[model samples]
Target: MCRWLAYSGSPILLEELLYRPSPSLIDQSLHAQMGAEATNGDGFGVGWYGLDTTMRDMPDTRGPDVPVLFRGVEPAWNDQNLRELARSTSSGLFFAHLRASTGSPVQQTNCHPFRHDRWLWMHNGLIRDFALLKRDLALAVDPALYPSIEGSTDSEVMFHLALTFGLTDDPVAAVERMVGFVEATGRRHGVEHPVQMTVATSDGERLWSFRYSSEHQSRTLYVSAAISTLRNLYPDNPAFVGLSDETRVVVSEPVGSFAGAWQPFPESSYGIVQPGDDVIGDFRPREP
Candidate 1:
């Protein structure tokens, strides 16, 4: 498994989100409390929106206003270059991920938080029988989108499969089809439980997260309590007071044990976070 976090709301320094908190994402890279693996050292990546361009290199320069992706085929904690990038960048919406290859190559292209134009995605679980599922899944991606599938991980393939199933028009529906296809394909190959995922994606604005598995035992997924709720719970906590009501974070696990700071995803559910209200509801896979 892997560890990842998605942040939306008041502009925050990447350093603060990745390093300042107790058991921060960087810390999780070495001592994850909830992931299947204690250390996710295969690789790492980050995608952030609206950051100073002069401070870092970018994969897609859609400009300073657009999201930029930075991936490294090295442990997050061991990369001083990543530390410099994190400290110098700031974004209102950003995702950071630590990877533990579940049969994928340990190259930059295989890192998490994969990007496709304005959309970014990362996953914390696997397609149970990926070697059997990959070919069928790859064939299902839109032909026009097929050439753009640059990585070999099931996570990246899921993103493209979602895109093929109409992600731009309806993310939830597309993911439904994607998971459905994975399950259906796996069953044909004699795999008992084909899906196991805690996936997150963003389109430089709103955020979407899903936690589900064909067998109903998905990996850990959590969303932060509303910033307002945190303020009331910990009146003296500066972290709570400094956040905007719009600030929200969804992670593989809570960064800290702060009271009223995290909420677990309901079994087999999905959540959407935007500028207004956030939502969580039952999730069901559908045919593509």
Candidate 2:
């Protein structure tokens, strides 16, 4: 299994969460407190939207919503380049993941935060018996998007399957459909409890996070208390003072030990973070 975090709010340097926080993602790469394994050092990736530099000529228009990605096969904590990039880059929405391979080769393309036209996705779980189910799952991807597949990891395939099932149109339903398909295929192959996951995806403007397992015992995941609420609860903490009310974060675990800073996302649930109040709702698999 792996660990990941998705952030949305006022623009801030990536290090603010990736490295500055106690038990930060950098720290978790080598000393995770709640991952299936103590370390997730196989590889790592970060994807974030940058200011549309291409709009110099037509400043009023927005360009294509493609995210800039930085992926590496090195352990996150050991990668100086990632540290430098984190210090220099600032984004309002971004994804970071620390990978601990589950039978997948270690390579740049196999890193998390897989990206598409306007989406970035990462996962922290496994599709049981993936070797037996890879072909069927890969076939389910839209033929047009099939060519984009570049790695031999179940997480990457899951992202593409969600895309084929209309993720851009309705992320929750698409992911449910993807999971349902996995479960059906696994059962067809005599495998039980086919999925274990805590997935996060974003379209730059909004973020969706989900946690579910076929056996009802999924990995750990937490969503931050709303910035406004935290501000009220911890009036003296400077960290909550400057952040906007819309700031929200979802992590594989609490970023720090701060009391009241994090809340457990219910099992079989998904959450969406957008302009107004964030929404947390029950999640159930749907047959494709």
- TM-score of each prediction: 0.95, 0.95
lDDT by residue (tens digit), candidate 2, 1-288: 899999999888899999998878889999998999999999999999865344435643335477888999999989999999898888889999999999989999999899888799999999999999999889889999999999899999999999999999999999999999999999999999999999999998999999999999989999898787888888897887888889999999888768888999999999999998789999999879
The worst-scoring run of ten residues by lDDT in candidate 2 lies at 52-61
| TM-score of candidate 1 against the unseen true structure | 0.95
Q: Kindly list the per-residue Cα lDDT of model 1 for residues 120-168, writing each as its tens digit.
A: 9999889887887788889888999999888889998999999999888
Backbone clash pairs for candidate 1 read: none
Q: What lDDT does each candidate get?
A: 0.88, 0.91
Estimate candidate 2's alpha-carbon lDDT, on a 0 to 1 scale: 0.91
Worst 10 residues of 1 by lDDT: 58-67
- RMSD to the true structure for each prediction, in A, is 2.2, 2.2
Model 2 residue 25 lDDT score: 83
